[model samples]
Target: MTLPTSTLDLYWLPEAVEFSTAVTALRAAAAKGADGNADAGAAAGTARMLANQRLDFLQTRTLDRAVQGLPDAAWGAELTLAVLGTGTLEHLLPAIRVAGLRRGLRVRCWQAPYGQWRQQILDPAADLHRQRPDVILLAVDPAELLPDLPLSATAEEADTALAARAEEMVGLWRTARERTGAVILQQLMPLAEPPAFGHFERLVPAAPGALAARLDEALVRAAARERVLLLDLGRSLAEIGRRSVGDARLWHHAKQAISPAAAPWYGEQVGRVLASLRGLSRKVLVLDLDNTLWGGVIGDDGLGGIVLGQGSAAGEAFVAFQRHLRQLSRRGVILAVSSKNSPAVAEAVFREHPDMVLTRSDIAAFEANWEDKPAALRRIARDLELGIDSLVFFDDNPVERDLMRRSLPAVAVPEVPDAPELYGQTLADAGYFEPVAFTADDAGRTRQYQANAERRQGQAAATDMDSFLRDLDMVLAVEPVTPVTLARVTQLINKTNQFNLTTRRYTEPEVRDLRDSPDVLTFAARLKDRFGDNGIIAVVIGRRVEDGRTLDLDSWLMSCRVLGRGVEQALLSVVAASAARRGVERLVGHYRPTARNGMVRDFYPGLGFTALPASAEDQGWSLDLRTAVLPQPRHFTLALSV
Candidate 1:
């Protein structure tokens, strides 16, 4: 349970000496735990323990070897990722696989021969065309793409070359995306080249460094324009330093753009993005009060005596950490407080402290009690209407952190620092809230949660469920999936689980196509109550089938916070009306159960859809458009904008 306080521990993972023994135990435990035994749980813990380590290349391979062949039951989600680049990608595969294991994914990878990425992408006969990849990472190195412009060339010449290269890459991305129906990821060229111009590197427009820099910026813009995820390898390279990640001898001997030694770090960078796409990224930040956020326990030290805010170094460090949390809140990362102190005493500091950066309102949930840390975290997730896995626990006490890690392997418990000064840096380094796209809903996340709290209070006060919903004036805005709502729609498509039917995920580009498609009936539902607005809470997609008489419900998911508020009733009503208007005779609803989406197992049957023939626990329900009389929304005033 010793927290890493210095760079000396960088070479090994926690308990590295016993890693091989642990792996052997893990294999035995996996088999023994399968027959209704506790061995599976032990194997999982061992896997998580080994997977979260900063291992050497060989250790990563060993972990990957053990986990890769496991059943889909062991992994949260499965996806095939194709890594194509101009350099030696074979060395990076083990890291990617191990990284996927860390992030709760079973990533199967495919690579083009040596450097035949272009032909693999362009020619239908290539092996890439035969495989259906969920994600494609174009790891094309800048050395292969960026031209060798002379030092005397003008800035305009550099701009022209950058534009051409950006277009070429974008074209490749579009072609690959079309061929594979996969999400595209573009890797930025790392700052591998030391400044040839040294101090004058910034002054020369035609220098190799200048073109590479320009190309990096160009690729970033292109990625944004095309909705491609940019793996900023350069940022990680800068952090790790090219001197460590780059090997000159290997580059000269073979076209190894990046060295094998850098695989662990490189894998982490790639894994973060790949995991994020599947809505596996954490959503909430739970902070401990005593000695974690500030210098002392407020229950004993009192507000004035506590060391926080300005003045002393310890006080300033806590303030800096709070400031970081506030910034995260502004970006839609939900904040919560879990403390072992009296609720009134802990909240008084937030309300009255003049130098407090995070006010009580900034936190979505505040759980202050004498309960154990595990139970406290569960209550926090329940209050937020999020799964236990969506929570990230931060505590300075090493014992509490260890207990949390062992108890909830799904929840992210980062290796925090013992010192107050390093708190913010450690949390930021964990990458728990890695975001791919920021929507309007994200910016106003705190307000939305606070509003939900008010709604919950309203429900508690009312005599009945019907009366409570009626008392709160709710507005359900049903809109067609337009460009404005595409980001939020795609976000909900991935992150939502509890109420999601089918649990199908789509990238932004694919969502855009659905928005523009004539055959798809897409609805993005937003709810607003008397308290405030709940930004884009639900998304439902209905696709026309070959039968032409039925509109198959392709996906239905909602934010769990808005579950009991009757949003589904109004949304389904609108869908029924829209489908009937399109001359469809029936609506087919599917419920493809996942581990996290069991809450809505009987959703279709509950809504009056007749049961149809099902396969392998997946139920199919059909509603006759000709004979069905769908219920009108009772609780909310509905606006159908589509």
Candidate 2:
């Protein structure tokens, strides 16, 4: 098969073109050589370049039919985003749409009128409140926020001004949440110019730069209280170079604060944030050992001879990459190895090498055999109980990377740079593991998965299922929803796929609404056994129906980690007892089928509920609470909160 003559072909296309024409060209390029034998890695790289060009072109050229021409029904997810900013954001729509399309989301953006952010946010009957967007982007400019701060102001005056600005912004965020209940994505103020005091700005607490820093800190604190997510526009600007991203001419002419040329970059940053919030963030990073972890193959080079540490330039580069991987691991990204080498040799490097930054303890699973990389990756995913699509693979060999791309197109196979020093930067730029919020549960995820592996091993050794569970010494806790557990419950509702009956996704605010509803009963499950603590693994929401005579199970999902541990049975037992206590005669359960939830098709039937005929994609089941016996697992000790 023939490859694209040059990756730069798209770059040479005319800068000005109709949006439809550019989109057609992009689709044609992506679809070229569908049955051909071109290298998958090269094709992916070229496609990305072409997509960037198309987005850039679209941002500058307006299309009357932009929204109508968007691909329909094929996106993995959909989001209604309301953009409320002080500056003109008409040019931002095309770029945001393109970014969302790249990330497999159909983004419908509604822009508030220019400079009407305050009116829109504060008014209860505004368009924003009426639209009820899923996410809100608050992109206010610093000058607009603190216009009174001048060069002559004293440090004390600057401090007071900054404090007032912080309070105003925080109040706005709280008001927006109360009105619309959408996840707030607030852009931190960027420093468009240097402090007027020059060197004295560093010395004076009230200088513009110093005040800006103080305001940023206050914003961070404010965000923590209300769970607001701050998009670090300052960092993005620094990365892209402030001079390249700023346009004074556009700011004066059209009230456009950011440069049109940088629209695509800003859109990309926003897309990553949106993806994380929608539960599309990647969960695993699968790495190859030879040439990826070190300078040479472990089988050929002894642990002492391999390059990984500070002695040489190449070695230091590998060390930096390993350090970055470790940092990612600390933030709950599971690390696994899928190397083609002797198992013994690989384990020795992780175990015996003194210079190794990543040890065997850091890895959740290690698959070191001379198997095809794709199979190894699949095994790793299964071992961790994660979807294969959630895994990101990295390898230095072009052939292996191409093979992975062709075989497992769902897996993200990033192009590793030839130079080792660029590895960490390249991975960081990809933003595959962006997170909306880091909870206590996130920090302990690696350990929890490791415990799962241990539990699996114990199960294998047990003679029967009953014996296996009994030996686990399991304890299941059922508790009413509280403020502390609300975030995790919402996360489970959004992230859990398998073993979910309805496959419903909810944002934090929606979860809060359900929890507070007088007619709804919401609770979470926590399980611990001889292995370890599996924190907040399951969630159940039941709605009172038929004048409180029946408890309808609105949603039920359990994490895959606790699937085989009888947790579901225990949860159902609790629900039944609760319903019976509430004078409910029967319990109703609904099952909605999705592509990812086939594992639970027989869930209600297996639990002795009578199925009623429903639509082709859904099933309804019911059980009489007065007569139906609650299934009790002899192995587990259960407790319920008052």
Give candidate 1's whole-model lDDT.
Answer: 0.76
Colliding residue pairs in candidate 2? none
- Candidates in order have lDDT scores of 0.76, 0.72
Off by over 4 Å in 1: 1-17, 30-42, 240-642
Put down candidate 1 lDDT per residue, 334-413, tens digits, no spaces: 89988898898999988886457788989888999998889989988998899999999999888999999899888899
Candidate 2 structure quality by residue, lDDT tens digits, 295-385: 9877886775577754357876887788667657756688899898889989988887545778788889899987899999899999899
TM-score of each: 0.36, 0.35
TM-score of 1: 0.36
**Residue 231 error for model 1, in Å?**
1.0
